[model samples]
Target chain A: MTVSLNDLVFVAMALVIVVAATGVVMLKNIVHSALSLILAFVGVAGIYFQLSAGFIGLVQIMVYAGAISVLIIFAIMLVMDKSVEKTNLFSPNIIRLLAGMGLTFLLFVTLGVSIWFTKFPVVPAEGPVDAVGMLANLFMGDYVIAFETAAILLLVAVIGAIILAKGAEDKQ
Target chain B: MEHLFINIADAFTGWLMNLGLSPWWADLALLVVQWICIVTIVTANITVLIWLERKVSGFFQERLGPNRLGPFGCFQTIADAIKLLTKEDIIPSAADKLVFRTAPIFFIIVSVMLYVVLPMGDGMQIVDLDVGLFFFISVGSLSTICLLMAGWGSNNKWSLIGAMRAVAQMISYEVPLALSLIGVVMIAGSLRLSNIVAAQGNIWFIVLQPIAFITYFIAATAELNRGPFDMPEAEQELTGGAYTEYTGMRWALFFLAEYTNLVAVSALMATVFLGGWQGPWLPSWLWIIVKTYVIMMVFFWLKWTFPRIRMDQLMSFSWKFLIPVSLANIFLTGAGIHFFKWMGW
Candidate 1:
């Protein structure tokens, strides 16, 4: 009869995420599927907020929910309509379905075991005074290399996308 | 983040405890008040910005805009609201109705959400996450999905081109926008907007990072798709662009959303780089209002002054000029900071 706020947020987020993912999978129109994927990503971001990962939650909403979804939709727009909705897959293979089911079962089992065995600890929020400086130090000191790598990765992506889009324009 | 909320909540609870009440009631009261404040500010801004846009545009063109209805056409927006509410909502014959109906609302809401993290003054922000600047840029990017929805949902080729243009413009400009801010973030040594403002307490970012500031200003203007960068809605090229099929009230929603977003981005720029509400004599909120309106006016001025840039040139400017300069600025900031620290400044 009594529902905790966090529990309610978690359940609602999960339901929305599941519905969105299923919508993404089942939509016949590629564009509609891309839009559904954005909704699903947003749902995941909601769950991230509920899990108390403030930085991760915003990044989820921004990078994946915002940027990548747009990229996917833009890519969908570039391709000519083949009406793949009806013939996207040639006859659903039973083996593929079984493999998918098996993978899902394994994932659930592993997740359940982790949930049962692990004693999760909530990390206390560092006082606001130390927090900003601490984050800056983390990124600048220990994770400097990773940050640099991410910048490089973004550079590579920009180059590749420009090449692809430019080639298409030239062809046209 | 938990402690941050807890402290704010505890301050209220501490007051309640003075009155000999439990902390739970104070926490509940604080939540209700903050949520209400957030909704009020966002809705109020959207409404006022819509009216302001029409008045500004009319003044720029030598005509009184919507002046027949209310004092100085103030309530023109109100009449427009009534018109929209009473109009029959039409779905295109082959349009995806669900997405079409939902897209505008999402666009408005997402744009509104970006303001939550934007600080109007020192310590006057909703959330003070360490990644506030990054968070703001990221949230703004979500509008592209809404654009794509509006485009595809219309089932029109023009709409689709407009949406595609938006996607290209936003993504292309995002690099320089984020990169320019890295210089500010480097100089400030923090990504928190409040911290950035406080860092500029003595000297603003514009003084130390002028190149980055200009780069950021241009990128922000482009990001909002204003004036010369307003290729997505360039009427001549794309026939009203992505919202080509939209008519009546649906058209108005897009118009209102665009102006509101312009205000949001301008307010954000003022906060992050313009020393946000920090000024002589004036109160913080008033300073914010003055700076925001000034930026909005500049937007209107640019809209009237310059012709829209060709799409290729706009994209080329970002990739060729802005991106390279921003990259250099980032390095300069890093070296500058290191040199200052080494010199014991």
Candidate 2:
């Protein structure tokens, strides 16, 4: 199989994402986890680029890697110990872990069965890259309300964050 | 996606068909040339920018900038570069050495990457990606990590405080900085920087999105840590902020990155709002230079005009005022676009 350069880039980006996500989970240091989160975000942006979602890729990098990562780092700084300790789950019972695993397995089996049984026809309309144009059209035409809602949601988040941070500062 | 990649690959293959060499080798050659162009432009701009900044700063303070070493201090940055090269690189006694060393290099790379899609003249861009506007913003934000690294690696209280403030301030203003562009993007109906510029062939989006343009300008100023928004490195308060302990070349990297960021952001503003590379009877490249320098002058004026806002005040202003204004601008832009279409004017 002749793999094109884009395919190579896509595979490389996916590998990066997986590795960075693993690092986030496995890294002992909280700061390291935060930094790894940034790496994961960058990987996601790369994937977005491969998908030809240039605007979204940029947003992912700017908001997640740039703004949110910095916010997390600041949060890390505010915390007393920068070291990583073992996280304790409330339930130490083996039965609980077993039940959780059982539920996850059941979900996977059910999803797989449904997908296999369903004979859904692939309605070919446009390629995935055209999703950008489609999304913009929907945003202005049919999904304008939802788009406005997203803007409102971001505004609310900003307000909430400001209040929370300010309330903490006032107490201090 | 496969089809797109195949097309690009096939194009390369066709180009190398005459040479009787494998297309893969031609692809590699193309990549090398692209990278070389990117690197040469980035490095040359950084060097030129450093000199321009020193001269600008000196002129602002009513002093001779750097006329000693070379003509008009043309080689001043070169001399400074040599000094930095020879200076003993010092790590803070309690600093994390690995991140410390990695941070400056990452900072430089991020700043350099900003030039990738930036068009110096008509059809003269390195990579005219469709999402050029967003790419610039995204890559531009990566420097914040380097700043954090500088702050954390210094192991000084001042450095920590500076880094913390910088991270907070930059993140806070990003909301407005980004949201403000929605109005322009709406007016242009595309996210591509080139398309946005082309849309302004007759009347610039700035006329329609004046509020957004101003909001973006102010927010981006804070984002770039210039002047009134420069609380992160307020020497009077934080003792050089995040870079309290950086010396020699590492410090130079941070300095160069900041100025380069200023240039990039200013250039981006020109591209998005101020009729990028567009004017009457002037060459496109000359228009770019004019617009870019004009924006840079505004930055200098901003730095010299307003006093730094309190950190808390900066945060609240962005969250409370700028974000809402930008969102409103976005909505207004949507309505305005529809109305303009209806009028068919």
Candidate 3:
């Protein structure tokens, strides 16, 4: 079959995502790693766009790439050790490198076995999805109980954070 | 009356079709031409706005701003453009060259992408997506990356500090900005910007949801990094902020992006709250322009009059005060809508 524009775009987006994900893991500088992670996030969002899910694509960029990436960058900046400058990114120690490689290889094998061996059936797309409205309905109407539970969970997390940050005030 | 731009676009596209090009090719050509026009308009507006901002600031300080260049100093930006174009582009030795070179371009791209959903006039938007409002807000949030990139790439303490503060301030303020819009969204019952404007055919949402308008305006000001919330580029403290290491056209791109974002935010406010392009006598396009300019002037007024707030104050103001107020405004809007429906009015 001849490749269509959609097929071309999908392939391009998938390739970009793979490369960006590789950059995220391989980059030595934490800041550069975070930037590469964002690129991967955007690429995933592009894949969503290719699926015609514009709302989800936008939200993916908004939450994952925009807000969370900024948070990651902030953490990197705050925790960075500026005094340490190394020419080689990887450690020269043999045992540590082997251990890391072994762990990664294990992960790859597990994922490969799980995904490649599964008998998944493909579902062809019927028509365009009203992502925003469908999502809003799912959260607000159909699964509102789950939605409110998630909100409460977030509130609990916020309180926990406040307590952690203000621990000194409690003692004083 | 029909949209002026639509008519012109139709004429141009029709002429292209007469050249015997394929349908998709002609459409692609139209898209390219429209993009060129949009970029030109954005650049032109940024130039005029930079001059206006200077003049407004000058007037605030009781001085003549750039009077020597041309009538009302209109040509001053043109003069500045030439100088900037010719100026040396410097990259610090310690900088990450790739990110440093790419940051400003990314920043400008994010700002320009914001204009895609903007309804410049009645039936004169680029693309009226179903999730237009969401698209605008999401794309607007991505500008933080540009700041983070510029700051990290520069390898300068001040730039890093500025970027850190800028991102923190922007992200915190973004919650309230988007929340405040929910009140308007609830009232409009649609996420489309054009529909929101149309919902205000009878009256503007500013009058109905005054608290949301106030909350949105304050949050938006902080989001745009102007006035009391202008902590990111507090030149006294952080020098030039994220673009500190940048010079010439690179810095110019960042500068242009700021004004472009300003125009975008005003256009959004106009569409959401001020009954965009909806008036009696003048054309709809002129009405939208007038409303946007007024909102922009209000932004300038706030910028000039207010003192720069402390970082703690900015953060607290967003979380402690604005967030709760916007949430309450949403509840109030929801209840009011429900009450109206109950009464069958």
TM-score on alpha carbons, each prediction = 0.85, 0.82, 0.94
* Winning model by lDDT: 3
B-chain TM-score, candidate 3: 0.98
User: Which whole-number lDDT from 0 to 100 does residue B73 have in model 3?
Assistant: 94
The models' CA-based lDDT, in order, is 0.78, 0.79, 0.88
2 or 3, greater by lDDT: 3
Estimate the TM-score for candidate 1: 0.85
Error of 1 at B28 (Å): 4.5
- Give the alpha carbon lDDT tens digit for every residue of B217-327 in model 3: 999999898987888899998897887899999999998899889999999999999998788888788888899999999998889888899999899999999999999
Q: Considering lDDT, where higher is better, how would the candidates rank from best to worst?
A: 3, 2, 1
Candidate that beats the other on lDDT, 1 or 3, i.e. the better one: 3
Writing each residue's lDDT as its tens digit, candidate 1 over B39-143 gives 677556766766777788888889777788768888877777778768887778878687777778888777777777777654566677667887788888888
True contacts kept of each: 0.71, 0.74, 0.77
Q: Model 3 Cα displacement at A169 (Å)? A: 4.5
lDDT of 3 by residue, A127-153 (tens): 454667778888999899999999999
Instruction: Write the number of the candidate with greater DockQ, choosing between 2 and 3.
Output: 3
User: What would the per-residue lDDT of candidate 2 be over residues B200-219, giving only the tens digit for each residue?
Assistant: 98987778889998999999
